[model samples]
Target: MTMAYKNVIHGLQKDEGTKENLFALVFEQGMSTNAASIKLAIPRSTAYSWVKKEKEQRSAAIEASEIARQTAQAAAAENLKVNLFALVFEQGMSTNAAAFGLGIPPSTAYSWINKEKERRDFTGEASSKTAREISKEDLKENLFAMVFDQGLSTNASAIQLGMPPSTAYNWIKKEKERRDITGEASSKTAQEISKDDLKKNLFALVFEQGMSTNASAIQLGMPPSTAYNWINQERERQSVTAEVTKETVQETVKETLKDNAEETVHETAREISKETSVETSVETSVESEEASTKDADSVYRVTFKL
Candidate 1:
């Protein structure tokens, strides 16, 4: 019916090998009809017709391949999401940092974090019915067990135990503080060093030792948040102190310059007055000598006349 169909029939009659080659190129190799036409030196219309028929024959296989490709892509994306989530929640990485590290978009990573939190809240609410009434001490013990033994995040453990995340965090903080006070904490920095010594160490580590905030925090056995807060406050205090010191130094310099300027002006005025007095005295002496000489001349003239 079509020129391509006619070409196919001719090919079949002339040589089956040519027809097979066309099928192999268009079907097995997945070459486009136009491309196959050039490769096989066949007519474009013949190639199109052969490719169309081959597509119909292999439609199921093509559909299956596409589905497989989509599934694989979806699986890879899910794996990436899981890894990023773990990095943020389990490993204490910030969402943006984790996203950047994993080459994920920050907005997408934030959405995932929100979804996970929502899921956790829903699960916590659903399981609240089975939540047992326990003493504060028992709850604290369980929280510690979940965190230390099972390696669960504080938020995750709080959700499992049907407690608010803030409450869990506060309880943990208090416990740590109590342990530190009793010298039972494992951190040598916290247990052995006094508060003043700890502050000095933190300052030296960051400013004098030229360490990063995180590294300083680690060396001081303090939470990064706490370390950052201390560093920020210290910087603010130092900034204020520096401003005060600069003002004081500037004032001192001004005072010193002012005194020197005043003393120089006084000395200049005294020198000018001394010079004026010396000139006045010399002029008076010269006038007195001239008057005496005239009187003597008059006296001599009078004597001569006598």
Candidate 2:
């Protein structure tokens, strides 16, 4: 019968949820069309159509009662944003607390603060960085204090300091390496072992005791890859020493065998020469005896003839 009814006839139809929500706001909560529209993030015309449908079945007193309340809420929110901006920028009050005190959402307050910063910077009234922005040095100092004094983890400290976990981890690593912090162990072991000692133990385990490099490393609380590297280096060194010693032993054995062979040949030649000399002396003595016998026979014959 009214203009609202006319609008409802041509209005786009919404889903059941939207219709139920509109019914609750308009009838149950007694909110006006404009207020319900703002709260529901819908168009005022659409809310008016929904309200028209409600009005055909309900009374006008509810809408009138909620109009003043909705107007007041709209005005208060606008003023609250202004106050929140001033509190955050001029009075140094945190946006979160200011928003909570004024009954504004924290996310909306943060958005307003960012808008204010942008406006101020555009007008050349604000510096490049906001007063709330923390410097790298201050952040690092706070992170260090949180980790050392409060006993927070690097990740937790970084989160509190508004930094990435990786950045915090890298900074801590650099500091530990630079300061030679012995308290921090790579593994879960309470005691820290020196590299030389680690290498020695690894060598004894793998080479002497025939343990696998990975198992030895795990036993010593070292990384398996690191153990593998150390083992390879030690094996190379041993191999070089073994080659040198083997060559030396071979040369010594060769010289000893050569000396023994030469001495044996000289002694064999002397024995052969002594046997030949004995044979020649016996032959000469036999020849001399035969010649003497011949001379005795000739003397006997000449004496008998005279």
Candidate 3:
């Protein structure tokens, strides 16, 4: 008999007005259409079409869920970006600093700022900054001064101020792009010299050569405040090195003293032992000589009496 007939004999087939085994076999049992069709006594085409429809439905459901998850993530990310921009634009935080505070990368922060700037520029949106934004303006002015007056590269300036390199580079680049449409060459250094040389010189003059901060600042042609700031930061870095060296030196001195003390004690003990040994040997030799002389005298006396 056919498997369909066997299925009917075994009561696997549903009676009239009951749930059909064709769908049950494919859906619940995960059977292939050919197996389900044979087992449920149904046409192969019917089983194939049902399975295809179920597969498409599941695929559409999965796609919809994924889109919803992405939408939620985007919304959350937008909120974070708003806070990041507020820090950069209003509070004068560097883009990298803001990004770090928000647990993001420097490049992502730079990209977001650039995109925002482009959007604002395209729309001609001149957002007014509060009084707090003076710092940002000051930063821009100082960066430009470094670029135009000091002949320093944006990278060097950024390093000097502990700001992100990309932020400074892009700021200078954008300013140059704006002025390119107008016209004037900024005096940025061609060789991109590291302004850190100034710091090194300042430190050498003050810490190494015993010069005062004022004298170092004068010699370096840097402002007194800048000199102090740089020197103070350097001092913090060197403080750790000094502390470790101090501990190492203390331990070395202690070990040397202990070794020297032990050697001195051992030498003193050896000298004392040698002196005691020599004194004891001399006394034994003198006592033996005295005893031999007495015995010789007594033997002569006894011979004469006999």
Candidate 4:
């Protein structure tokens, strides 16, 4: 057609084709070197070289590209995974809780949780440092209602809640200690911790500051009857303590008195015995002015023994 050709064989065009002649059989027919070579009656090596040249030229057109975007995306994913791990395992938060905090799906969080479980089981490592904070609500509401409001023992509360009694006890003990250490800075308000806490405060105001029960109740935002009852209990407790102290003092005094009297008697007897043990001799010499029969003398011996 254009008469511009790349290669020729005798009088036929090699890179050009007509109805009676064909060229570039390997590419035009989409044939492999083996098939094209046999079809075109050419050596297999010649067909292979043509295919190789095209492959090299096409490959040469491609250039290397920077992958910073992809690297940053991968790093962000890794960081998310690390944060999820810390919240779920290290902080003792549940999968759903950690997921909610991270704004991730709960299903994804649970999947990661299972994967971590398996990894830790295989590796024999533990990540948790404390019990879950979510359980504090159990202590504040459920356990408090059962033990204080319903008059159930701690063990009974545990049974009702389907947890180990020791777990409940430890949680309560630690919570109380935490509250004691932090005071007003505790996670819960004082009344939320226990209504009795408010009652005790009311009683303290009444007894310590001599405020009336009505005034204390009003100040503490409690019912007057409840405040009065708590104040009465506190007074009764103090009365019992006073009675015990008085009895103890009386018994101590009696013992001391009896022991001192016995000791005084024993000491007096010892001193008297010691004084009597020494010798007391009285000798008198007088010239005999009147003696019976001029050589007769009378002598009397006086002796006192203790």
Pick the lDDT winner.
3
* Per-residue accuracy of model 4 over 1-306 as CA lDDT, tens digit each: 334442235235543332112235555766567877687676677667767876676566542223566677679767878998887556555566567778888888788778877997677664542333444453456775665454445655675565557766876677567757977334554435566566567767877888899998778655566667778888899999999999999999999999999999999999887766542211111233345334433332222221
Query: What residue pairs clash in candidate 3, if any at all?
Result: none
**Per-model tally of clashing residue pairs:** 0, 0, 0, 0
Rank list by lDDT: 3, 1, 2, 4
lDDT of 2: 0.75
- Winner on TM-score (2 vs 4): 2
Rank order by TM-score, top first?
1, 2, 3, 4
TM-score of every candidate relative to the true structure = 0.40, 0.38, 0.37, 0.30
- Write model 2 residue lDDT over 1-306, tens digit each, in one string: 899986776563544567778779888998887888898888889778877877775666677668888999889878997788766665555566668777888899889888878888899877655544444556667776665444445765665555557888987777667546665445533123345556888899998999999899879766577788889988899999999999999999999999999989998999999989998898888888888888888889899998
Distance from true position, residue 234, model 1, in Å? 1.2
- Tens-digit lDDT track for model 1 on 177-256? 88778976665542234555667888999999899999987776656776788899999999999999999999999999
- Candidate 1: which pairs clash? none
Encode model 3's per-residue lDDT on 1-306: one tens digit a residue: 999888886663344212256557667887777987787676777677767876798799999999999999899789878988888767777887788789887888899988987887687664665433687778888888887566565666786665678878888899878866666544434223335567778889999999999988877766677788888999998999999999999999999999999999999999999999999999999999999999999999999999
Q: What is the lDDT of residue 81 in candidate 4?
A: 82
For model 2, the stretches where C-alpha displacement exceeds 4 angstroms are 1-196, 294-306
Output candidate 2 Cα RMSD. 14.9
